[model samples]
Target: MRREVPLAITFITGFLLIIGFFIPHDPIGGLQSMFLQWYAIIAGFTMVLGLMTLTRIHTRRIVKRTQGFGYSVILIGAMLGTLVVGFYSGIKYKGLFELGTPFMWYYNNILVPLSATMFSLLAFFIASAAYRAFRARTIEATLLLIAGVLVMIGRVPVGNLIWNKLPIIAEWIMNIPQLAAKRGILIGVALGMIATSLRIILGIERTYLK
Candidate 1:
């Protein structure tokens, strides 16, 4: 009965939303707005649920004294501290959580530097991976290697000294090949989304319910 009720609600809601897109009338539009509000409320609850889940998992790890348990403790402490400070301080003035607040101080000093260091480490790892990948084994690999080298050089002032046409070639590769490939992937993704949405509406996609 529980499963059936949710499935029925999903089917009805999906069908109504599909219909509402075509018929932009009074009752359907009103229903869509109300549904969106309800969705926002549900989303808020989901965030709370996610935080609870995170706390539970970390607390269990701490209790078990598992490997990297100290990291878990630190994560839980940081999360709870951030939440308390954010709520207590109150974010006023549009994305700036109250000047001279504990939240703002923690965010600016601690969070920003930590995030920057993480990204810097990520760049180092990415460069190492790219070096491994760009070996001139095959024609395709050679072409990729050349393109990557040119792009890297072209972005700096030294490339102009090396060759006048390097920047132009780099720009052409990015604009033509890269942009075309990106568009092709986007089109495929859009088609897949449409297919998935249709399947969901038709009740052929039941994994979501599960």
Candidate 2:
């Protein structure tokens, strides 16, 4: 009964949403809005459940003194500290997300810098990957290597000094080939999503229930 009920709900909700997209009338449109609001409320509760699960797992790890327990301890401490500061600021300032609040300060000072550092580290990995991928083992790889080098050079002022048309050539390659490739990928993704959505709506994809 549990499985059947959820499957029925999923089919109804998905079918209604599809209809609402095409026929944006009073009842269907209103139902769509109500469903969206319900989704948001459910999402909020889901996030709370996820937070509780995370805390429980980390607490268990700490209790067991398992390997990497120190990192788990730090994660739990930081999460709790952030939540406390956020709640306190929300009550004191009547807005949790206002500028200059303690939560915002922590976000701006700590979180942003950490995020930047992580992305900066990606540059090295990207360089390594580029080196491996650009090896001229075949005609295609050779062409790709040449194009990459040209694009990189065109982005710098020295490329302009060496050849005046290099930047224009680079821009053409990006606007034509890169944009076409990107559009092809997006079309493929859209088609895949449509197929998956249909499978779920038809109850062929039941793994989500588990």
Using TM-score as the measure, which candidate wins? 2
lDDT of 2 by residue, 1-210 (tens): 989999999999999999999888889988987898999999999999999999999999999999999999999999999899989899999687799899899989989999999999999999999988999999999989988999999999999999999999899889999899999999999999999999999999999998
Candidate No. with top lDDT: 2
Worst 10 residues of 1 by lDDT: 88-97
- Candidate 2 whole-model C-alpha lDDT, 0 to 1: 0.94
Off by over 4 Å in 2: none
RMSD of each: 2.3, 1.7
Supply the TM-score for candidate 1: 0.88
Per-residue alpha-carbon lDDT of candidate 1 for residues 1-210, written as tens digits (9 for 90 to 100): 867877788888888887888887879977877788898999999999999999999999999999999999999999989988788777543444777878899899999999999899998899999989999999999988998998999878899889988888889989999899999999999999999988877778889775
Clashes in model 1: which pairs?
Answer: none
Consecutive 10-residue window with the lowest summed lDDT within model 2: 91-100
Give stretches of model 1 more than 4 Å off.
91-96
How many clashes does the backbone of model 1 have?
A: 0
